[model samples]
Target chain A: MAIEHSSVDLSDAMILEPTALADWIITAPVIIPLIAGALLLMIRHETRFHAGIAIGALLLALLGHIGLLARVLETGPLTMTMGRWLPPFGISFTADVLGASMGLAATLSALVCALYSLTDIGARGRRYGFYGFLMLMMAGVNGAFITGDIFNLYVWFEVFLISSFGLLVLGSERRQLDGATKYAILNLLGTTLFLTATALLYGALGTLNMADIARVMPEVQDSIPAGTLATLFFFAFAMKAAAFPVNFWLPASYHTPRIAAAALFGGVLTKIGVYALLRTFGMLMPDQLTLLSTLIAWVAAATMIIGVMGALAQTDLRRILGFVVISGVGTMMAGLALGSVEGFSGAIFYAFHSILVMTALYLLAGVMNGLAGTYSLRTLSGLYTSHPLVAAFAFLLFLAVSGLPPASGLWPKVMLIRASIDGGAPWLAFAILLSSLLTMLALGRVFLLAVWRPAVEPSTAMVVSPGIGYAALLVLAVPIVWMGVYPEPFANVATKAAAGLTDTSAYIRSVFPEVVQ
Target chain B: MQTLIFRTAAPYISSLMVLFSIFVTLRGHNEPGGGFIGGLIAASAAAVYGIAYGVPAVRKALYFHPMAIAGSGLMLSALSGVFSIFHGVPLMTGVWGSFGFLGATVDIATVVTFDLGVYLVVLGSFTSIALALEEREDG
Candidate 1:
């Protein structure tokens, strides 16, 4: 195969000598939960111990991610090829700042979700091995983040998909089954598209290692199929991320699952799609993305408008949050479409913010549903008066997500606006502003109707929610407030991560040491 | 609905299929047949049993739970990867060990262990789902 690489000659690109002991950190995040999840499946007879094992595994993963992040931040990206094989030939898992940070966010969100599951998951869900599925999903998420091979990314996606399929139908309710069917079918389509694109990409570039493809992309002659490859990837990722046109599945199905299941999905699943989009477009295919930037910007605008409009029209609280999740996707997509350092950084920042805040929002929604005995806004009232702590978390998340000041969401919006103007697209900035307004308006309606509305006897339901659920919500909320208060450190990390995305020299050098002159 | 011919032949047929699956799994690292294929083959054996006899008979033939088997397979695969850490290599790094037994040398590799794990997981997961659906149908 004639591989045209306009970048540095990779013939000289040497693999880095594996660090003896510390390399385990790179694999720990994926392996710990995987082994735990597998073992948990064996002991399904004892449901009581599943939650503890899952939580412990997640905490270990989180610590590993934190360590990996710190190391990557201090050093550069850390790369390891499976079986100590050479790069390109071996599946490599690399943790750059962007990947590690996202991994950390995912692990944190998953840990909270696991904790919340202990209180929120019913006996039927537990009996069906919810914790085991949750751990497996976490392993998949971690694997996807750190994997350096595009093909491996697809594998991880499947792992998560299978586990999520298990989680989605854990309750086996009629509504859940209906939702899972739609979710499964659409996602399968997306997966097929992803695989086809990946095959074409490998055919064109003659390599599946992401860094190698990026290194060689400039040299590959532009063709119709090349353009189609980008479009295929866009559709595949967009469907998963629940972008404008293909977002119906999310709102249609998300609210039907158990609250913890929905919360996990809301928190990290779509964000994985977003992460893949940003990684591919921002890092691997920046030049191609620049060509399609205008179209992408328009998609961003439409997604933002449609998502908020959908949220505005929903009467169910979780459904409203579901729409809000879609709008958040649009916001990050707008940043991604700009295809600049500021834009990429903003997208990463917003992704972390979205993951945490969305999970917290859904957890709060679950709490509300538990207390009121229904998710319908028409029947639920006096939450602010009855459950002030829960109501406070909801209000904080609402403000944060609406891009209000003193919240982390505002800083990312500012960066995206700056990037839009800098990238010569003022209309995108206007779309973002307009979308934020719509989000506030839609979410404000919910606030007025559900929280501020007059007392309606407080629908005294048997709330079996344990204190851990509340604790999980609070644990997730802390990061949003902290990031909002002190944006500098986090922004610095994001800025460096964004630099890694745009300038792949360091990443390529890390993976292929021999290539560096 | 069970046919007399199927009931008479199922035991031998399933046993042979299970043996073939193990053989395929053991050779998967060097050849086309690995854990996934072996698992499918094994699961098919269970499926055949279910069709000829019933879900309960199939379940009894496979003493352990299908989900548990799958989980154990997953643990085995993960541990195989972790085993390299003890050798100061990256996770999933292939490490080989050989021992001289009498006049023959016995060699072992983590890849084969990992492959076996994959086989068990696939066999266990599919069979469990298949049994669940089939049992539900019977009820």
Candidate 2:
């Protein structure tokens, strides 16, 4: 894509005036973290300041993404091409409601994590680069969501993957190393598959821009192994999402990191996989997605069932939360499998919903660990008598995660179930209900054992959860509770995002205005 | 393990490679050479120097922590893109600047600053890793 310096007028296209302020909004989520993370990395000995900068960086990124989301919701998709090069030539960052909302949600969750790290992350962990890696991961997550090119998506994947690897083993504990080892091997495999799929798709279509590929998919479908390529993409994202049998690595490794790190991982890490699925299959290759819908539905059911069953078997609180994360992925996958406007909306809503709720759940796990000095459910008791507010927060978040009424999780689950029924997939509807029921049972059991039951023995050490820690949980809880109470505004955006994915005309039009069909 | 001839030749090779690395970085957009390769060459020069002398000597010569250099480069690379924001363009849009001095014109671009940042990051990270490995070996 070399620019031919044929004339001055042609050169003028290279430096168009930054009209309309949307251009800056399009790329700020990525660049802010890139600058802030690197700056944080240079200062090796200031935990207080490092945490402050990390929070500031994420807060700024979240604000930018909020602006981006508002613009996308008000108007349509936003596009920014690198070096002023047009699409199918230069790399582009394109954001629709789906990407914009995802970025904002991830940034919000990450901001909470950064704040919580102030009290939760020890000086040793801060010295080892907690905030730096967290910001680095946010950059990757936002980039993956916003990029219009498939290859750029893979590049962003690697960026976040490397950062996660850094965060996973930051403490260099034996268990952390062991968990990181497993995490690395599986994720690398997933990344390699993703790269392979991207390469093969590029070879088949001769283009890597997502919108370009979608536009050309019909013309090229007959010539290429489009189904297999789609499956390759599906397989890569499924493994990454920890859906069904491919999910072992998530449970094995996710519980090992520090809670702040784990909260971020639980919040947006798996959702990235789900987001990629939605972008590639829902928006970019709907036909291929339709072709593979049934198999995906079955996989989704299995992922939901097995994930909750694993949670039921786990006594480790953090470990149970990891399984709960896996089950939520199933719910998102089920939404993907439905392949309807409602289903897509449900999935989009669920991913953002899960990002907020699941992250808070993990942070709650940390706060509980701070209070009770453990992650094990067995030796913990009488949380209600001691910390009624913590118990109440736990109760609300559990209600949300398990898809009980009047919590954020319930809306997405209802949307998904309704979508499945409307889409004539009663079995999927049944599966969703059954998984939610089991999740409630599992979490209810946790509540009974940890919060309701009296103390098994007299407690010795009293480590009250830090003020910042509660503030972090409060920050996260407010959103979950708010979304639960008044979901119309957010749900409306989700509907639009789903619509944008289904019809990608606006998305494609944003990237290449002249090529709109 | 270093012989007299090897030690004597190392310094010349190292210095020449460092010089060539800068040339490569300068000609990066026009030619095949770029910041990444340039940085690799520079890092290799440092490694060779460390082999000839010691990690301590290389550290003294560098005068800054390798990670600090890498971090500065990251900041530079990121800020280079930020320049476009103030100028009213998307991030990474290449804006040009020209300066007239002594009846001569000098042109500069954000892309070059980005490349330089990439160079420093690569050089810093690789040199640090090399230093760490060599220190462990000497220990």
How many clashing residue pairs appear in each of the predictions shown?
A: 7, 1
For residues A73-119, could you state the per-residue lDDT of candidate 2 as single tens digits? 98899988887766688888999999999999999999998888877
Q: Tens-digit lDDT track for model 1 on A26-69? A: 88899889988988999987888888898999999999999999
lDDT of each: 0.87, 0.89
Q: Which candidate ranks first by DockQ, i.e. highest? A: 1
Compute the lDDT of residue A422 as modeled in candidate 2: 98
- Compute the lDDT of residue A78 as modeled in candidate 1: 90
Distance from true location, Cα of A501 in model 2, Å: 0.6
Best by TM-score: 2
What DockQ does every candidate get?
Answer: 0.60, 0.57
